[model samples]
Target chain A: MKSTQRNMRRDILDGLHVGIPIAMAYFAVAFSLGIIAAKAGLTAPMGFVSSFFTRASAGEYGTYTLIAAHAAYAELVVMCLVINLRYMLMSAALSQKIAPGTSRWHRLLMAVCITDEVFGVSYAHPGYTPPAYTYSAALISSLFWALGCALGIVAGNILPQQMVTALSMALYGMFLGIIIPPARKDRNVLYALAASFVLSGLCAAAPVVSGLSSGTRIVVLTVLISAVAAWLKPVNTEADGEA
Target chain B: MEKHSVIIYILIAILTTNLIRVVPMALIKGPIRNRFVRSFLYYVPYVTLAVMTFPDMILVTPTPLPGVLAFAAGIIAAWLRLGLFAVAAICCAIVYLLSMLFAG
Candidate 1:
């Protein structure tokens, strides 16, 4: 078991090497989130807690601004629900990685750590995820994410307002980083991104569909894009380490 | 009616979101065999990020010209595989300079 522990640590380190870039990519958006929190009159810690729990920048920023605007509780409830609803797909995809035969206690812990980052990496590698490696990677990535937000919040609090405003592109740049590397290697991925963009834009531009709630629009777009991509290119991802 | 009660409501809302995200996977633990489903699952993050980034693009001016320019600059910087900090710095510099030129 001692040797097994060493092997697990090594696996985590391997994951860390890959995950560091993911966290660095996340910093720009996470920092932007801090700026949003400040504008919303939320304390820095309040902003940090959003990342700590959800690790989702868009939803966290939406919640912060909605609260700031004194938006309706019912609307905020729906926005939160719809924005995060994609995680359901992420978690479902990650289910293939964990030990299917395990007990509820194990599933409970894995569920807590299943962010988009973890889910993306875990799904890309199908098969038996050594519990130790998967959990440790999640713990480490979550820390990097949470710590980045905490630092960004503190920075946003003290920075000059103009200086903060200049950072609007940082989040886009970060997302670009998260996506471009993968898309560069695969035309299918590129097509999915392009299709999703045009489709979503059309949805927004259309008069009738434009009346739908923003959250509903987003969910619809996600489902549409995923469905099309799945139909275009099928992948059998039942086994572990297939990618 | 109190402020504390409002905070509690927010927390519960957030918790509900987390639960909705986590519960289905806990129960659904079979091999995903649909070829199309697997292919799309693999590509979803790219689409998701692209979708999320569209509305969030920051604009420093009424005209989208400068923001568009900055967006192009960021993509170029990222394509060159610049570090995250460098990509951000370049985008902001372009935006700051453009804002000065246009507004001044």
Candidate 2:
């Protein structure tokens, strides 16, 4: 029992070390989220609480967009589901690394914490990951994310109006930061990015498609464009092993 | 939205996101081996980001020129493989300057 406890402590410490960089990364993204939340007319406290409740960045942004537009509840729910669909895949991948003996409750707990960075870091673990390590990493990274959101909200309220408007541009920059590097690396991603851009633009502008609610337009555009891209350039795992 | 409905919105967001995360992990064990499904999932995030950013990005700013300039700066920085912090910081600064110059 003593040995197990010692091992658990060491693992958790190691997890914290890995989690620090992730926390820093999330701080940048969540800071932008804070500004956007404010622009959407959310109170700082509400922004802080929502950030605490949902760590999914894109989903939170989508939620804010819908709320600001006074979208219906069903629309907001569907938009969020679409925005956060990636997490399902991430948790699915992480599930494979967890030991078979882990309890269902533990799996559910880990699922709550599975973000892109957490899942990526966990995948590097050579064998079964201890629950302590996963939980510790999740706790630290999420705490930083929440902290960053709170800081951003406070700063948003305090800053001059001009600066706040300027800061809102950072949200788009953050999204570009996410998609650009990968698009540069792969032709397929480049093609997919262009397709998504043009299609989304058309959806917003063309009279027929523009008539749809923003929530529906976004969902339809994302699904159709991504499906086409996937079918056009299916990533052959056989060719690029472990990509 | 009413104060009460705001609570409902937040809860729904949390519930849907957590549902996706929890349901998949609980049901699927072992790496997904199917190439088609893997490819589809892989493309979802980037495509979603791309679609969400455009049009909205251009419309968000007070003027389209500042918005386009800021977006161009971001694209260039990201193409140079700058880190997310650097890209966002640079774009925000550029957008602020351009907005002041043009919108003033």
Candidate 3:
């Protein structure tokens, strides 16, 4: 039992090494979110605390916009649900990769921190990921994310106007870095990405669909484009370690 | 809004986000067998990021020019397999310089 505990501790540290890069990316993104939260009248602590609980980026930002506009509570809830529903698919995929015998509580904990970057880095891991490693990675990544939000909120008060505008691109750069490597390696991913881009452009420009809220458009377009890509070219992901 | 409403908003965010994430892991114990479904899940990470990034990136910046330039720089650097730090730094520099030049 002692040896097993030692091994698990080792796994968590190994996970943290990879988690650091992801944490850096999250820091950049959350910084932008922090500034937005401040602009929306949220206190720094309120913005930081929200990052701890709900790691969803677009969902948090969307909620801020709705609250500022004084949208109905029901609409806000439904919008968050739709904006964050993609996490269901990601969590389900991760469930298949976690080591067998991982406790229910550990699984529950992991589920709470399933951000886009967390899932991406974990999924790209070659084989069966130990529950401890996954949990540690999520813990580290979320910590940095929350810290970034707190910093951004604080910094928003003191930073010059032009500097904040420049800093916002850090999040965009992080997102682009994440997708480009995979899209370059796989033709199917490239197609799916193109489809998403075109669909997003049309949804904004095309007269009829243009009426939809940004949240609905993102959810609908992601599902439609990914499904078609999967149907047209299904890659076997059975190489995932199942220990 | 009242000061207390912030707490309510955070609660709502936590409840909704975790609902989707937790329910799946709690119920789905094994690898899904359906090829189409598996493929769909596999493709989701990429498509979700792509859809979220575009259009949204354009809107976040003060003007289309700086955002577009920054986005183009990021794509080029990332495609070259530059590490995340490099990608972000390059894009931020480009956006900053362009905004300074044009929006000045």
| Top-lDDT candidate index | 3
TM-score for predicted model 3 compared with the true structure: 0.90
Q: How many Å off is the CA of A213 in candidate 1?
A: 4.7
Residue A17 in candidate 3 has what lDDT? Answer: 77
Better of 1 and 3 by TM-score: 3
| Candidate 3, A134-186: lDDT as tens digits | 77778888888888888887886577666677777777787788888998889
Model 2 scores what on Cα lDDT?
0.74
Write one digit per residue (lDDT tens) for candidate 2, span A45-150: 7777788768877788888877777778898778877667767766765776678778888888988887655664565565877777777777887887877777
Computed on C-alpha atoms, the DockQ of candidate 2 is 0.53
Cα distance off (Å), candidate 2, residue B87: 0.9
Off by over 4 Å in 2: A1-46, A61-79, A82-86, A89-110, A114-141, A148-155, A238-243, B1-9
List the pairs of residues colliding in candidate 2: none
Could you tell me how far off, in angstroms, the CA of residue B100 lies in candidate 1 after the best superposition?
Answer: 5.4
Assess each model's interface with DockQ, reporting 2 decimals per model. 0.46, 0.53, 0.65
Best by DockQ: 3
**Residue range B16-52, candidate 3, lDDT tens digits:** 8889899999998766777888888888888888888
